[model samples]
Target: MSALHIALYVTGGIAAYKAAPLVRAFIKAGHSVRVVMTAHATEFITPLTMATLSQQPVALDNFAPPRPSEVSHIALADWTDVAIAYPATANFIAKIANGLADDMASTTWLATTAPRIVFPAMNGHMLHQAATERNLNQLGTDGVVVAPTGTGFLAEGYTGEGRLLEPAAAQDFVTYVMSRRQGRLQDVHVVITAGGTQEPIDPVRRLTNRSSGKMGYALAAAALQAGANVTLISTTGRQPPFGITYVPVTDVRQMQQALTARFAASDIVIMAAAVADWRPARVAQEKIKKQPGQETWQLDLVRNPDIIAGLGAQKTHQFLVGFAAETQDLIANAEKKLAAKHVDMLVANDVGKPGIGFGAEDNAVVLLQSGTAPQYLPKAPKTTIAAQVISAIAAARTPD
Candidate 1:
């Protein structure tokens, strides 16, 4: 690829140090680069260090002394081909998502029209929080590409998915984005089911699962980044990321109906929701009263609709992916499901495994393809896992 102009935005996170090496990589790749930092980011790393490494003076404030013009933000915004925000803080992410230009860094970000990418770094708990995840989804919807965070030691002394990407990985992602001639998944319509379906038994009582919906949300975000039109079907109360059309359902039947209506228009369907297997035989119109000695009351249950299998039966040309969450004999059970559902691919994980299952930010799964040995992925964040799944699906669709 020819040398291109690049702008690097640093945020306040422990991973800010990674920006130095990232700047070096872009220089080594024959690209012209400039560095910009949020005021809070300066507390983590010095401008002098980034300047020395990038061979360009780091721009900190929108209006610094001796500028030829007062609008430095506009000048910087207009000069870049691609802009990247590394170690993007949750605060900055939310601001960008909401179009808030409260600071120089955010103002420049808002002023730019170039393709933007964000590499988020934070504590695992913050990364998984409802608000942070929602902002990330919004960024994706707004056409900003997010590189998945890695798992490792955090400044907060905890370990999980909020670690920033290694310098090498971040560089590769930048190159891939800048070198692409055409967007992947352009004009493709993708429907993704995420989180777990809830089955209400009473006004307040319901049955749900531990699914956080991170994996499915990540898939939708990635699909949007790859230039695909995405529709997210979710049962979890979390909001869908910014770029997706969301359809929320509380029961398996409702989910089935939603999918049935959209499946024909979709080029791909990923059934990532952990739908309830059974539901109450009757849902009381009002809250069931608790009476003395009522603990012995019995309620009947019935099997819920089989969403994936139904889609598989009705699907003709669309690619279908299913997920299998198992406790024991994971592969064997997943293989059975693969055959039973006639899915193009099955991602199976052992939820019993520590730190790699439901309600956790990371997951270790095996991708199963018919007549081929299963491919195992070590424990990693759901975002990275989603990327792997997206790559696999793309490869499967490639002509031999």
Candidate 2:
């Protein structure tokens, strides 16, 4: 899966110690984390420290980019896939609840179009105060997802409510909230194929493409975040993001069998895996050893089943999306596949391009569908492109 862009807002509180683990958890799960802290939060934990852990420069003040061409706060807003106020102090919560944007944290919170998640932490009485209660309710009214405060020992000697949530719990809550956002593909099952299926020529040798499964994994994660029931079928040894039903396959036959088993239950099927077009016609009982005099060898090849075309022809209610990676005659070839495969949409790209597509982190593609005009996706992170692709498929689905 492509890395998630997280904007974590840190505020002053003893619970601030928990923020480090929070950031670590996000990173461990393959998300990109950036800390944005209030001035007071600096006293509890150093910006340099958080920056080191997150591997991103912490934003302590909201200002324009050093270049003076772009507004820094808005840029952050657009960059964030989700905004989270971790260990939010009562003061910080009140400030945002009252429409205050005096600091970078508040300003970024106010500006972001992404979902906001707030973790309120403070002394029990402070949290129980009528004004604080009102502010918390106000935030809820504003559609901010608030995690339930855990009751435990406060910073003081006396025990009371207001403990920061456990890092793992907080992480799970954030993921759940993000999935519940608007336009969720709730109840829809999406089956996606990823990676390059290996065609074994012998026990020790195999033929495979350059696919790393980054784009397909990104699509699976994006679909999950969109609240779809995602089942990922992958051949690459790469890991998929959390929260998916994964089916692992190695060769052409296994991939075909996996897709056949899963496709019947899916609402959308994306054929992103670079399945081998041909396989060795004969299988050796063991690894084929080379003789010292053997300079040339011949192997017969046979065509593998056209998985996408088979699905497209038999698909009844499913939205079938196929992929084409061509080096020449791109448009005409993609259009021909779009028709011949009977796919609803085809995502095509030129693997010959430099630094994009085919195992790269970024890609540029042309989307061709039966009805809509061709849509071009500029070179960007695979996650962003996957999100757009998932949305287009969702938008095109016929209603019950």
Candidate 3:
């Protein structure tokens, strides 16, 4: 286990008392923790209690004297490996979401460069409010790991998803943030495809898959954090991280062309796009009208150009990865594709498995290498899986 330097920010909520136990858990896990309490949070839990548990003086204000000339907030912010806000109130959540820095807690959050996690706690109605939901969604999109609140009684006498996550779950999030391998893909170029390709059938009608592009987007973010320059080629409308270059394509042929043009420039290519396997033989000039006997109408379909196979055949020294989303004979089919496509590695998953494919945020996959037993990865957040995949790539590149 790595020695983690943690900064815990306590926000006002009925669950503020839970932060004490969390601090203790971190101490027990052999981490050095410092607690920062908002003025309102000090009402629910005293600084003495926290300082005693954390074995460090709790810094509650930006004006506090630092060990050096550095400001307390800035020093503490720099000292932390991961920062977390427990029992984040609706007001605090909005403050961070809107970039408000009225208090020490909010200011420290803005100053911290470390990965941040927030556990929200509030009244059931507040949690369900559209503004709150929007704020939470935005936070996730901004790459903050949020521990989902459990459904239970709130201090306001209502029962819903406003309770802070259990101590175990909070600790799990802390572990995750601290355990990530640092700068593993430094200076690498990663190209990824995402979402389902739309094959036009008419002016409006089209053929598409259920892919929501979560897996591909997650991979892009992970690779980016690992220090790789990422270009996400996606068909889904999901907005990628701020700095990544995104190329959107609506059909298989367009995607093939885009890949062909960009493949040689990328150091690593991950074909996560769910390109359509077939398309209408002839697209109608306009929307086909529904007639009384339209059930008898026929349409022709044709196979799409194989983008992955083309890249595989022409691939030189770069690492090429493929995704095999299968329902059955998973390993056998994936292995066949690995050989047929001449890929460096393949990620095979049973899409039919619950919570592992399509729009789901979590996934499980088997990493297939030529002549080696597939490495099984259990269902995890797409970000975690992406990091694992990138790590494997780095390992493969290491000299024997």
Candidate 4:
């Protein structure tokens, strides 16, 4: 991930103290932190304290203190990668939801195109109020991330669900959101398939491949960071990450069904899963126990659905990206599949190559599109490759 610059909004709440530690944590993790505290928030934590911790001037004024040419609110909002509202009170949440810019923080939020995250901390009753609930819902509907609150002792000497997450956990939450964020993909629905599908034979035996899902997962993460809503159909053994939809499948049929269900709503569909070419013709009712002296055992194989070709046959408005992992005739075979499957673009690689493809953390690929020359990306981190793919897709997309 690139180095991040954060605009941390501190609102009026006892949890404002937690924001102080969070600033240091952000700095320690090599991210830039700029604090923008509400006038009321100064009562709970001093602006001097926050500034000292963040090592930057606190933004407290609506306009520049010395140079009004620089609108403090808008400048800070535009400068940051993403903004976090720690100890976001119901009043402040309402202000943000309804577009009220009475204070510098609200005004900054209104002006920012970057992602906005709110960490609500208030009295339990205030948090539970219908207005607060409504504002929170509105924020989510508007694509803002609402961090979860914890139940703990409030400054009021009572335990409730409105307490802010601790500094450490809050830091992690910020990292998670930032890691998955990409402004280009914002609000765009994307679906991706990853890992090699498993075709079970008996209860204990199955056929699979070397696909680690790294490339596809990288694509999913990259699309997510680009601000696209993502759903991952994974055959990899790993669990899915938070914030995106995940559908686990073990066979090609399951993957096909999942893709069919999701493809209609997707703006882009990436077929990255390494589906099995064949499966057992008959699955034994129980494990096929080996005979003590069995010398000959035959297993029949059957062809699986050509998922990409099927989707391509009924092409729609969605941009389709297909991957070709070949051991021979790399470009020729890939182009054949691309044209045959009606793929909009093809990412082809030699899985047999050392240090690239399959389970490797890096990749080298040739990108082929309908009307463009082949674009070659040399070996690089999967995340970097993913960014390149998403950037290319964004460039190719028709602007709204």
Clashing pairs in 3: none
Give model 1's TM-score versus the native structure: 0.62
Compared with the true structure, the alpha-carbon lDDT of candidate 3 equals 0.85
Ranking by TM-score: 4, 2, 1, 3
lDDT per residue for candidate 4 within 117-151, as digits (tens), equals 99999988999999999999999999999999999
- Write candidate 2's Cα lDDT for 1-400 as tens digits: 2357999999999888889989998998899998999989999999988999999999988653544776778888899998999989999999999989998899888999888889999989998999999999999999888788888877887888877788887886777566755445977899999999998888889888899998899899888888888899999766565467889999988999998988888899999999899999988879999899999999899999999989998999899999999998888899999999999999999999987868899998899998778999899999889989988788778534
Candidate 1 off by > 4 Å: 1-5, 8-56, 59-80, 83-183
Task: Note the Cα lDDT for every prediction shown.
Answer: 0.86, 0.88, 0.85, 0.87
List model 1 lDDT by residue over 120-199, tens digit each: 98988999999999999999999999988899988877677899988887876775565343346767888999988888
Which residue pairs clash within candidate 2?
Answer: none
Which candidate should be chosen as best, given TM-score against the real structure? Answer: 4
lDDT of residue 330 for candidate 4 = 92
Clashes of each: 4, 0, 0, 9
Give the C-alpha miss distance for residue 375 in model 1, angstroms.
1.0
lDDT of 3 by residue, 37-146 (tens): 99999989999999999999988876666667778777888998888999799988998988888778888888898889888888778889999999998888888877
Work out the TM-score per prediction. Answer: 0.62, 0.64, 0.62, 0.72
